[model samples]
Target: MPTIRKKGEGQYHVQIRKRGYPTQTKTFTKEVDAKRWATIIESEMERGVFVSRTEAEATLVKDVLQRFASEVLPTKRSEQSDKSRIKTLIEEFGNYRLASLNSTQIAKFRDQRLKVVGPQSVIHEINLLNRVLKTASMDWGIALPGGLPTEQVRKPIKPRGRDRRVAELEIAKILEATESLELRTIVTLAVETGMRRNEIASLVWDEIDLKNQTAHLPKTKTDVPRTVPLSRAAVKALNAFGVKEDGRVFALQAESMSQAFERACEPHRANIVGARFHDLRHEATSRLFEKGLNVMEVAAITGHKTLDMLKRYTHLRAEDLAKKIG
Candidate 1:
């Protein structure tokens, strides 16, 4: 049923030839191991459940990651970030064969990465690795005999969400400190509409409908298009700049806006402790809740896919709640 021959010192080669199936061959260090492998392959063939793992055994993780980076990563909304992660993965796992990847190796990688990076970063890397493996298996027809290793590895615990909210005094200080009218306007929009820094930075005149009091975002972090209802404050801020039919609302890029905000807050760090530009979105969401907007209503405006995520961005003040209760 199978042929076993000694190729060299400590090298035993086994070949299995089935009438209905393709020939399977492997080389092992010991004759016993070679025989055992042949028996397993023969049993699977007899049971009609045999699937060749030849390609998977031969392919390296580096090659798959390279292919994925070229073909799949470009199409993703987070292509740049994904490319960075893929590069890291290739550096770590490039030498290992696809079939050799296992839960033990993945668990070790998770633990090792946790030492250098935060849990969330490790989680993202592990999730990306899983995505790459699944793509290899499902799309590329690579059959992993050991299954996906990431499925069995225990993921690190996610850190608690940030509850930072900017106070009215701090907001005023930040605005007053910044001489740039454009940065001041961006800050105002962030707090009023709960729009992310990127969304606000990438905004165009055409996306805004002053008559309807709405800003249409065709591209968002969630890749879901949403129309943010504009407050009178938001509208007035936009009106401060003369309206054009179509063009970028602000000249600043996302990174530049963040850097400018950081610079603006540098002088008042004592008062604006731990406050980031993203905190403006949290402030806006909390205000919406205070205004009696329901969960669904706030989610629609903020483009949050889940209530849990929306809750993370909303931090209502005790004094405000007490006033409402009274």
Candidate 2:
């Protein structure tokens, strides 16, 4: 028998006893809520599908944490990335019973998450959760029903890449503003090598081989290992550091670098004309084409995996193309 008592404030005290399951009592804010809970418990008990909160709590935390601890942390991903992503999932979807989190709930969750975080980040977090949920369903049998993201969610469109080649005069102004030797090295490396910001920040001495004129980048944004051939400008920029042994070449914060790159280009923005630092990759590829290199050679230089990926960087203004045709 289950006992219900009025506990003030329209609340109820619920107590239930069964032979196999221990006696449980809890206070609820509303009588209807209590009744709803009791009904679920009684029905689950009849079916032998009841799980006590105390017994299942540890499994939920462990199930979520194992992915971060084992799969994410061991990889060369950015330091805060794994923690940030896992925190988002746990904060939003944490309290629900793992067994009850289903396709409809996940869809609602996807919409809720997209409102706050970028749609792209929502997609990423959903993908991460799917991994955890899938493992729980298949490996541990913890009761997640299907893959999250049964349908593709739209990602926010990042603006078209500005591939403006910094003109020789504008490059001069940027070089002048880059007074700090470190900033100079970073800017020079970015323009010369076309390395992404994270790749540049995470660069290590072990990855460099000045003797062979190449850098064996162990990890990249694309998760593909690539060896960037050292350009003469890159070599000159590195020399400014002088007698470099080991440790990070540019320890500049990723955010700070982008800020400074923006500031340095402020005066010459009209000349370079709506190009971000990443556009340097496109600019670098344009330089390759101007120098008469073929498509295969340009792909080798830029580390683009496919011709389609390569084309995204190749936005040729009609004037520039006209000059080439002329």
**How does candidate 1 score on lDDT?**
0.90
- Candidate 2: deviation at residue 116, Å? 3.0
Across 1-326, the per-residue lDDT of candidate 1 in tens digits comes to: 99999997999999999999999999999898998989989999999988888998999999999999999987776788888898889888999999888999889888998999999999999999999999999999998887899999999999998888898888998888888889889999999999998889879998999999999998888889999999998899888866788999999998899888888888554345677988899999999999999999999999999988998889999998999899
- Backbone clash tally (model 2): 0
Candidate 1 lDDT score at position 110: 88
Q: What is the C-alpha RMSD of each candidate to the true structure, in Å?
A: 2.2, 7.0
lDDT of 2 by residue, 277-314 (tens): 67666666676776677889777667788987778777
Model 2's alpha-carbon lDDT is 0.68
Model 1 weakest lDDT span, ten residues long: 266-275
How far residue 165's Cα lies from its native spot in candidate 1, in Å, is: 0.7
Distance (Å) between predicted and true CA of 227, model 1?
A: 2.1
Evaluate residue 272 in candidate 1 and report its C-alpha lDDT on the 0 to 100 scale: 57
TM-score of each: 0.92, 0.67
